[model samples]
Target: MNLVALAARCRAEHDYNPLCDAIPYVRFLGISVSEEAGEFISQLAFRPRNIGNPALPALHGGVVGAFLETTAILELVWAQETLMIPKIINITIDYLRPAGPVTTYARGTITKRGRRIANVTVEAWQGDRSRPVAIAHCHFLLELTP
Candidate 1:
């Protein structure tokens, strides 16, 4: 299945985004996307393998980082009409709070998009949207091919 095509269908149908299934890691993490009031929201459900500190029983920081990063990439893809695959330039992540063993959600906003680069901001929250567990700023190199 072509994820770009799936995403387009979802966008037109105003249904769930199935593009996450095209990425193995994202599927392993149980990431899913939904549209809410014209906004796209990403979610990651709690899983045992995602636990980092077994003592704290909190999610691994790397897992959270990947979640945010992947969210940004998908957001960029959804923004454009073409099937462009973005390469990561850099990602800066800030862990604000411990992510407990609970379903976490992420939302990404494209700050800027140029001819070759795109800047995205993503936030991950567990219990409350206002209280984000972590935030990430990512720069991606766009594949501007015909």
Candidate 2:
């Protein structure tokens, strides 16, 4: 489905699975979203293929980074009632700690949203919300329709 159609379905059904399903990378990473207390919480399910270091059994840095970015994009989509898909202009991710072979959760907050740009910050954690394994600051270009 196209992004516009997917966005319509998401809004109609009050679900974001269609949006996630439309992205192959999001599917490959096993990323899913749920609404908790009026906030969108994204989850990265544990998968053996995602392990980058067999010795440490840690998730790949790239996987974590991608998850965080995806979370930010989804948050933007969920928060806005627009059909446009936010395009990532740039993202900076900080790997605070190694992610173990387990599920990870992330939440993104929009620091600023303008007519054509948005800034989002995301935090990914495992087991504890207070301690984040990774954090990301992302800037996306919003497509404004006349």
Q: Quote each prediction's TM-score.
A: 0.90, 0.95
Give the clashing residue pairs of candidate 1, or none.
none
State which candidate has the highest TM-score: 2
lDDT (tens digit, per residue) of candidate 2 on 38-108: 88899999999999889998999999999999999998889872348888999999999999999999999
RMSD (CA, Å), candidate 1 to true, equals: 1.7
Error of 1 at 6 (Å): 3.9
Error of 1 at 144 (Å): 3.3
lDDT of 2 at 68: 96
Model 2 stretches astray by more than 4 angstroms: none
The candidate 1 region of ten consecutive residues with least summed lDDT is: 76-85
